[model samples]
Target: MSLLVVGSVAYDGIETPFGKVDKILGGSATYISLTSSYFQKNVNLVGVVGKDFSQDDIDLFKSKDIDLQGLQMDESGNTFFWKGKYHYDLNNRDTLDTQLNVFEHFNPKIPESYRDAKFIALGNIEPSLQAKVLEQVNSPDLVVMDTMNFWIEGTLDALKQTLKNVDLLVINDSEARELADEPNLIKSADLIRKMGPDFLIIKKGEHGALLFTDDEIFSAPAYPIVDIFDPTGAGDSFMGGLLGWLSYTNDLSPQNFRRAVIFGSVMASFCVEEFGPDRLRDLTEKEIYDRYREFRELSEIPEVG
Candidate 1:
């Protein structure tokens, strides 16, 4: 099975209490492809970069067997760039700068080879663009989306239109509440289901993640860690791990979906321990399974009654 991911490919400058780093290869597709590469080899990336984007970054994806046929480079433009600084808690951050450059006019074109992908992940991007990618896909068995508050508030109509075509929607708890216009999470998810997607995954940074379906609800706790250097790309990494495991097993049942959530949580735990994309880049399959085993062990509880 193959998975298609659509999102940004750009440079980021990040600062934390520990220190700061200059421009680095960072983007939603970059982290997602890296994490997913551990479990699957046929990851098709769909996004645009600019002439300034390094070929070395492309080589990194190539080394992991990520197919870049769908990746486009704009010869005359510069890549998108973002700068941010993390707070002491690390969960909250302040954006220092954002330059959309090429991404300001990004129009993703789904390659012919990517049209038949079994799974499609619409990473955080303009809602209209997300809809365009969905329209391009010939037949995707599972379609999942990730979005932020910016689009939800600024492009409600576009976002709602895109939501109708996706099977799963992943967003942070705050965005979920804002989108649904409900303060309570459960109620927010219920309201969102009315909008479109059948499944909703609300990510609560450091607290945990919650999954809601029409018939069931599953909750998974975040791996408790004392050190969190940077939270960048954690959500995309989680999505990568979740879809990677699901595609690898070829199982879409609720039971398997719950397991995928745990796998995603574990992968995200590793993501926050280091700076931009460091932890995910060098992860091995054995290491991932080891963390999975520990998660299963810790999550299991004997009967209290």
Candidate 2:
């Protein structure tokens, strides 16, 4: 099964308690596609970049064997850049700067070769643009979309329209609450699911993640990561690992969805250990498998009778 990811691929300047990086490859699509490539072989990426986009970063994509046919290079301006400073707690961050640059005028153009993808992951972008991408692709087996508070607040109508077309929606707990206008997370999931997607995932940062459907409500514990460096792309990485596993197995059962959630948590735990996505680059299959087992053991109860 082929996977298509449409979103930003830009540079980020991150400052965290552990350290700082002036510039690193960080974007919704960058982290989503890179971490997904570990499980999904046919990963296709689509986004725009400025001439300032370096060859090293291009090589990084190539190293993972990600298909880049849909990537566009605009010589007119610089790539989108965002700088944020994380609080000492590593759970909150404040944006220092944001330069939309070429991304300001982004209009996704899906290549002909990518039209037949089986899985589609729409990263954080304008809801209208996300809908445009959906219109171009073939009947994808599963469609997962990610959104943020910015779009929820500014483009509520459009976001709700787009949500109707996706199969799953992934957003953090805060975004979930805001989107549903509810204080309780479990209630938020039900409200948001009524907007469109049949499934919803509410990420709780270090606390864990919740999977919600009309028939099932699963809770997966987060991998206990020590020495967290940067939390920048952990959510995206979680989505990637999830869709990556689902695409690899081509399974959509409730039981399998639970496993995918754990795999997602495993990838995310590794993501925060380093700035950007550097840690995901060196992960071995054994490491991922071992971590998945550990997550499974987290909530398992020993027989008492």
The candidate that achieves the highest lDDT relative to the unseen native structure: 2
Q: Write the per-residue lDDT of candidate 2 for residues 206-244, one digit (tens) a residue.
A: 899999977999998977777898999998999999999
TM-scores, all models, native as reference? 0.97, 0.98
TM-score of 2: 0.98
Best by TM-score: 2
Evaluate all candidate structures by whole-model CA lDDT and list the values in order. Answer: 0.89, 0.93
Q: On residues 8-120, what C-alpha lDDT tens digit does candidate 1 reach at each position?
A: 98899999999899998888988888888787778999998998988778888988999999998888789999999989878788999999998898999999888999998
Error of 2 at 263 (Å): 1.0
